[model samples]
Target chain A: MLNSMLEFVPRIPIAEGTEWVTEWLKEKFSVLFDPIKEHLGNFMEFMSEDVLMLIPPIIFIIAVALIAFFISGKKLGLAAFSIVGLWLIYNQGYWDHLMNTVTLVIIASLLSVIIGVPFGILMAKSKIAEAIITPILDFMQTMPAFVYLIPAVAFFGIGMVPGVFASLIFATPPTVRFTNLGIRQVSKELVEASDAFGSTGAQKLFKVQLPMAKATIMAGINQTVMLSLSMVVIASMIGAPGLGREVLSSLQRSNVGTGFVAGVGIVILAIIIDRFTQNMNKKKA
Target chain B: MPVIEAKNLSKVFGKNPKHALKLLDKGLSKEAILKEAGNTVGVNRASFSVEAGEIFVIMGLSGSGKSTLVRLINRLIEPTEGSILIDGEDLARMDKKSLRRVRREKMSMVFQKFALFPLRTILENAEFGLEVQNAPKEERRKKAEKALEMVGLAGYIHQKPGQLSGGMQQRVGLARALANDPEVLLMDEAFSALDPLIRKEMQDELIDLQSSMRKTIIFITHDLDEALRLGDRIALMKDGSIVQIGTPEEILVNPANDYVERFVEDVDRSKVLTAQHIMKRPETVNIEKHGPRVALERMREEGLSSMYVVDSKRNLKGYITADDASAARKNEIGNLEEILKNDIPRVDKETSMHEIFNIIHDSPIPVAVIEDGKLLGIIVRGSVIAALAGDAEVNIENA
Candidate 1:
């Protein structure tokens, strides 16, 4: 599996078009473009609303802080010192731009959960849903990060919308994969106990089964956040601003120091997000 | 009349018909269910009714239908065929709403793994069923507290299942079931996962609880000792079918088949039997010799039951009660006390149960063993037979 994955990893970036090999394979499987376009359209409309763009990210930042506090208490304040340190080193003010990335990432993640969880449940319930979905998940996951930008740019043009859009597709598969896995892995005995004790289908899903699968689902969320953060730098090459744009501009002008600094900023952001989400999962568990 | 009845209950998996025309079909046969499952025959055509308040046990080995059978009683898994009637209402025929209502209102089940909802505190786990049924929050909370109290987990209500010991987790499961206050409690080998000592403690606790609550219980187990300890009538199962359904005494004495007889023969009857089995028969002699006068008087006083007679050594030889001794003289009376022989149950303290059983079976009277008999114990024929059976507890009445 590892050998195949590594060998396939380089194959994904080979848009060095196959002039000889099978045109039939390309045309037969080319239904993804239109749906991807419609999704990009819906995403742009959703993000255009001020409340949709503004309030949720702010709430998410607060929720992240609250989660941090609950786990390590006033220790979270000490971590904020590094945040200030990054701002000083970047030289340019990053508060608004960082907030935009946070906002867009949060919105994408929320949508992933909303869409992914139901898809997961449907997939879990039916073999046909699983059969259709599992291959799509493989394609989404194995397809190159850079390849996502090509279509995202073609469809949504360039903005925070496309950045969030690419991140959603990349990040969503984890949540959906893990949700189905988690729900399916729950002990049959527990499900029977719930049913035997007279839990309605809706009640069983929400109360008994969902809660039991929570730890695994939370793990999926952690994976999603990490995957979304990974897309942030790549998405910056298109036009989504934040640390990514700084890295791009720094590299373009050959300001190696500034680019390195921006790279450090993204790495630090990933670590912080990763740690906080993991800690939040621990607290919930 | 029986409170619960299963009419030819059967279950089959796969969409394939028994005799399939299409090659795509998975064959429907025991071998097919086995090869596909490789190790399960959840339930078969099992039919039995538990009288209200009866401790009905369905006993089987793993992969036997005990779990699936009880689940069928409550319709947890919809039976592939047949119907389940609870108090004259068909559970299998009920609509979803009525089925759920029956579950919430009539029956609650406990699981082998505890399944106590680790995400919730003990109180919340107990209250989950009530909450699902849409009970008032305060009422449910109060009821959960009461249940916790009943299970002796009162102080631990706020603790999660992860924090509790296995025994305590099972208590929480029990508390959760009891909180709903249903008429029937289905125990799916509830104590099977616990340590032996904990299992014993839980079994004793269940007996104590059932004594007070009198819930019509359908308990499943593979252990004959457990079946004997807990059940009023045990249904011995092999594969998916019930081999025998009887009190422990009946099952022990007269197992319907060799499989059941073999199952009972290996069980330790000592754990099940008590002094009640070999008690001295009822006494009919007066305080003195020549005590009774007429045949009618002897019949009225003795009721034909035997009385025990002992020598100076306290050794029992044989017994002749007023009924037999009175036959010696219809017109005249005899020394009723002296005339009666001591035929109380006799055996060495170390007498093997098989020997004792054989002796009792052949004799019309209970055998009396003598060796400085200080009246240590007597084995009643009924109880000996009971002890060898599946779920009969001995009841001893001391003189």
Candidate 2:
């Protein structure tokens, strides 16, 4: 009797409904989506090809190593690691792919911070906003990275722009969550002191909250950059170019040696980026 | 007019504050209202006015709402009901722009935890208030420098707050408020976070600053001794309500209720009770009008061992013991000044009992209370002990 009752319930058409909604959004918002795709795609390509590719590999590697040296307080470890790592990637003939991945990750992380901070501030300032945004963030974070590619392709067609869109959906939550947590974790007495001195909302935010929350926000941004880097291999499924494409093609041909080299290149990039950003945070302190 | 006036000011925390306020007006107790309405009363129908250039202290134990009461004055915590007035201007009714202007121009606050921005240098922390007001950069920098110098932190201007000790950090906090040059200051347990020695040093500095600056101040503390030491007048709070508002002496001598009485019970009375509160009228002989024979006779009649000698205008000359006066009379010394002993201790009327204890311990005769060379009263050992024992009424007749 219970089985019959369970079978009597009709299945919900969530998949069909989502498809219809996506198609409707594509048809209706093409004007808005088209310009963003064209402009952003051109900017990303210009950054990776025109700007980054213009630098000689040796010069770029030395510059990054020097920056690592200074930012890590004259430490030899990070600078040595950067030089060795970049040299290995260059020797492996994945330097251009490395640059493409760098451009994709940097743009995605910047965009996440720009959009996430204000939303985080809103969540911190208002209970209603926090309540409304929290569940949406959870949904975005838990949803599989592959699930976003469909919408990303629908919105931006393909390439680095769609890659960024998918990565942004995957990576933006940490920044928003951390910014909110950082602002909320500021001592109550400090907030009261700010208010007591007649600080306007903007004044309190910029002067007191943001400066105090810096390390935490930087940590969040570091996580975001890592998340964006992780999205590259997945993003290549939609024709986004980079080491991710190298890895994808190697996977298809079952070329374990090439795929392993490409994977090592990504690991080297992640460590370099992570160490540089972490060292920057420590330098400020 | 008062510099800051709060009338029927109240703060209720939680949802349905309107209902809580209605319950407050119906005379329901704080606990009852909390139980029935799920609202906590922060400050309950508080009404007080702080005079210009005086330190008006609000004192209570933790959670008694003294902090809340002070916050209401500056509208840091918006009142659930009632109004606040600054120089006869209704602050509660002011728009946001005007309120911000008033906050910038009229008052600033200091906090207990030394809320200096750790990332900013000491000079930049001091510049915060003026920076918020959008003052010119050069002007704000100059004022911040001057304010930092005022707090004796000129040497540490370029150092961040994290590099300084607790007391020095608090000095930066103080400089931050002073840079604005506001007319009034609200200090919420501003020295509570410091160790006892540093707290005392800060208190003395605040008193010194008050003497020169004479800015109206609203100070909050959970310490009874601090309240007595710094307050020109103190309001004692209990359970979100002010139970008494009076001078420290009044609060100590005649507490408004059992709660206030218990609150002040452990205060060191010697620090608060002064010579004026414990002094007795001294029987004196006028040297120009009376001889040693008359002085000896007057001493005998009053049953005193010694008598203070004064001139026709009542300036303290010295004192004559009964033996000295009698011996002088036998030796034909007509002037009382000829035999008078000049070794008696003298203290001002405002001298604390703590100081009198040190002086009176070495003196054979009573310590004479003098003002401008004229004797007002004398503090005897018995009187000092009596005052410390809470019998301040013993010398009220002389006052």
Candidate 3:
């Protein structure tokens, strides 16, 4: 009798619900989503495919070294490390993959900052906006990166475009949250002093508030860049090409040596980027 | 005309301010209004006028609405139900653009915390007001440099505000305001955050500055001595309402109520009351017309051993004591000038009573109160003692 009763019991219809919701969103917002998808697709291809290939590998390496030298206060050590790291990646025949990964991370981080900062400023300025955005940011931050990949692929089809969209969603929360916090944390007395001087609203925001909040906003940008880097290997599952793809292939073949080497290369790239961005922040301060 | 005047200024810090204002109109107390409408009355129907070139001080302890009242004058805090007039233009009726123009061109403020931008250099901070006015860069720099020199901060222009001491930062703040060359200055406890020694030095510097600039200034503070020293006229506030408005001498000698009396109870009156306040119309003999016999007769009639000898224009010639007059009488001197002693101590009419202590101690007779080489009055030792001892009946004739 227990077996018979269990056989008749139906499973929850979560899959159908998800599909229906997905189709409903697509139907309702295709005009918005289609243009964004197409523009992002074109921009990603141009950055990763055209720009990386247009510059010679050695010149790119030297340029990176030069940037590192300036950002790190003319430090020979940082410039040497950046040069040696890029050379090692080249020697390992992973230069193209490295550039691809870089392009993806850079594009995603830039888009996150562009969209997130203004929203964050809105949140800081208005209580209603903050209330609405806070929980959405919490969900974006806490959700597993793999869980969103399915939806990303569903929305934009399988490509680097979907990977970038996924990375953008995952990396955006910090910039928004920190920007809001940074503006809010400005000294009340300073704000009052600015207002007392008859500063227009725009002047106060740009001259006083933004300059004061630079360190925090830089911190947010750093987080966004790092989060985009972390999304790379996960993004490889959906035909996004890079060192992440190489690592994924090595993992699939159970080739631990190749996977470890690629992992080390990603680390080297991250260290170089992180040091450069942090030095840039210090210089600004 | 007054530079700034507020008529029945009131500010309630909550919604439903109209209800609180109605209660206030019905003469409800601050607390009663708060209890009735949950509206905190920041300032209550405060009416006062600040004359141009006069240092009008608003003084109160914490939570007494003195700061609020000052901000109301500038429209930084809008009044709930009153009008503020600047040069006969109602601030409440002005549009935002006109208000901004007034803030830029007419008045500037100095903050208690010396609100210099920490990230900006001293020069930049000093030029802040000029920059707000959209002045050209060259003119802004020139004016800022001049103002900084006026404040004795000429060499620290390149340094950031955080690198300077608190007193220096406040000087920069002062320069920032003065750079605008505004018609009025609103200093809200501008020196209250400094060390005691630095605060005293800043006060002396401000007095010096005021002597030359003579800008209409409204100073706010909680200290009685600062108010008395700096204020041309003082408005004492309590519980959001002005308790009294009077000159320093009036406030000290004739406190409006128990609260004001208590506020001034611990004040050092000798330092506050000048020689002009306690001076009397002294007995005198004209040097050109009087002989030793005449001087002696005048001294005897006045029941005094000494008489000041003055010219026809009341120019202080000298003095004649009883011994000198007797010597002159014996010698048959026709003019009192031959026997008059010019060694008597003299003080300006505005010299404080505290300074008179030393003069009166050294002099055998009363100190002569002189102004512009003419004798105004005499500050006797009894009057100094009376002022020091807090004698209420001490004659006070403010110069």
Candidate 4:
């Protein structure tokens, strides 16, 4: 009886629908999307391949260590840890791969924040926008990150750009969600008070709303960075090269030791970025 | 003309305000109107005027719409019906731009929560109103500094609002409004959040500020004591409608209805009622109009040990006792000034009964109520004691 009941449930055509949508978008909007793809590709290459590689390895290590130290309020311990961590990745011969992953995460996270914050503010201001965007955010967050790669590759075609495109979708929801939540959480009294003082709409937004929502927006940025890093290994499957590629190849060849070392390198990089951003948020507050 | 006036004002907080108005016109209660129309009446057909430099208080309990009324004066919440006129300019008819100008230049508001910007320093918060007006940076800083000094917050100019105590933060709120140099101020329960002692201190500070600044103010409060202390004339509200409008003594002595009577039932009449409310017409012998013989006869008829002496113009000169009057009459003295005693205790009509007690206790005669050297009335110790004891006969007669 259970088998017959199960058989009665029709399979929905979700994958076919997704394929058609991607194809239709690519066919109709290629002119618009191609430039964006080209620019992002160039920018990613410049950051990961050109500038990072051109700089002497010792100088690069010192710069990263300095950034970590300054942003974390001169925490010598964290700076030393970052220096040691980066040195180990270099010693283990994964320095270039680490740089590639760092560039991808930076680009993806920056794009996410730039796009997500305004949408989040829109959702905060307008009920219709909130109603429409909320379910989209939920789908983006809950849907398997791996599922996004199919359409990313379908449109952009196998490369670092597609990897970034895939990771962008996986990472944007936090900034959008948190920016909306932060603005919404602002006390009604403060908003009314601002209005009562005859603050223009723009003044109120820049002076009151944005400043009050800083910590939360920073929190969103932090989450976006973390989520972007998490997508590195998945993105490598679409030909994006990074520590993720190292891990993927190790998996394919069943080499546990190489994968573990690469994974540790990613974790160290994440901790360094995370602590810097969190400290920036605290300083702002 | 009144600086601010609201005529037939009403505010209903829902979609079906038309239905709410209909129900209200039929003389239904706020609850009934709300029930029938799915609209909550925030303020109902409220009509009052605040004169220039006067503190007009709108007082009620939490749900009685006192806050809503104050907001309506500034058009913070647009009224559902009627019109508001500030200096005879219809606020209800002004465009948004003009309204913004009015808020910037003509009127300012202080909130109950001490709505200082959390991120801005005390000086910056004070500069907010001036900045909104596009005041130049130098001018804004100067004006904000002056205002902060006025509010006794000059020492903490660079400190954020969160660093201050609740009382100090509220002072910053006041400084923000004052910096604008607005003609009228709208305070919506501005001190209701403070501790009791701080609230009293703020009230006294506001009174002192009002005397010096003389700015027209519309103040809202839920506490009867605060209303009595701060308001020059108060309009008591209940269920979104004003039940009575009177001076504090009038409200105490002659409550408009049962509700108002009960509202005042718990009030200490000695604290609120003034000598003017209990004073009676003084039995006087005019020095220019009567001789010492006449003064003696008048004192005898009134059964008084002494009587006030006023000039022909009713200017209070002094008092003369019956013994002095009799001595003057026997000695054939014509000038009554010789027998007049200038030490008779005199008080202003505005002096509260609490202060009158001390003056009346040591006085040999009734305390004469004088304003600007003109005798208005005399406050006898018995009548004051009677008023304070809440004697119905005394209150009724005074009313």
Chain B: TM-scores of all predictions: 0.77, 0.73, 0.73, 0.73
Over all chains combined, what TM-score does candidate 1 have? Answer: 0.79
Give the winner by TM-score: 2
lDDT of model 2 at position B157: 94
- Per-residue lDDT over B1-399 for candidate 4, one digit per residue giving the tens place of the 0 to 100 score: 888888999999999797889888888888787677789999999998889999988888889999888888878899899999988998888988888888888999999998888999999999999898889999999999999999899899999999999999999999999998999988999999999889988998999999999999889988777887788898999988999998765676677998887776555576577777888888999889898999888888889999999998899999999998899999999979899899978888778776777688777899998898899999886676556534414433353
**Tens digit of lDDT per residue, candidate 3, span B228-331?**
76888999999999999998767766779999977876555765778888888989999888888988998889999998999999999999899988887888
- For every model shown, what is its TM-score relative to the native structure? 0.79, 0.84, 0.80, 0.83
lDDT of 1 at A277: 75
- lDDT for each residue of candidate 1 in A161-222, tens digit (9 for 90 to 100): 67877888898999999889888988888888788778898898898767878888889988
Which digits, one per residue and each the tens of the lDDT, describe model 2 over residues A226-263? 99999977999999999999999999999999999999
The clash count for each model shown is 23, 0, 0, 0
**Worst lDDT window (10 residues) for model 2 chain A?**
A276-285
Q: Local error of candidate 3 at B78, Å?
A: 2.8
Instruction: Note the DockQ of each predicted structure.
Output: 0.64, 0.80, 0.50, 0.68
DockQ, prediction 1: 0.64
Q: Which ranges in model 3 have alpha carbons more than 4 Å from their true place?
A: A1-18, B25-37, B267-399
- Chain B TM-score, candidate 1? 0.77
Q: For candidate 4, list the clashing residue pairs, or say none.
A: none
lDDT of 2 by residue, B1-399 (tens): 898889999999999899999998899999999999999999999999999999999998899998888888888888888899999998888888888898898999999888778888899889988988899999999999999888899998999888999999999989999999999999999999999889878888999989999999999999776776789999999989999999766676567898887776555576567788878788999989999889988999999999999998899999999998889989998898678788879999888776777788778888999999999988887665546544347555544
lDDT of 1 by residue, B1-399 (tens): 788889978655455423221211343545556565443345667899889898999998876778888888998777876799998999999999999999998999999998877788999999988998999999999999999999999999888899999999999999999999998899999999999888878998999999999899999998887887888999998877788999866676577998887777666565434344444443333333334454336556655555454444444434555566556566455655545554355676556556676567666665554446544445557656545533244443331
B277: Cα error in model 4, Å? 17
TM-score of chain A of each: 0.74, 0.98, 0.92, 0.94
Q: Write the per-residue lDDT of candidate 4 for residues A157-216, one digit (tens) a residue.
A: 887888888888999999999999988888877887777878887877887888899899
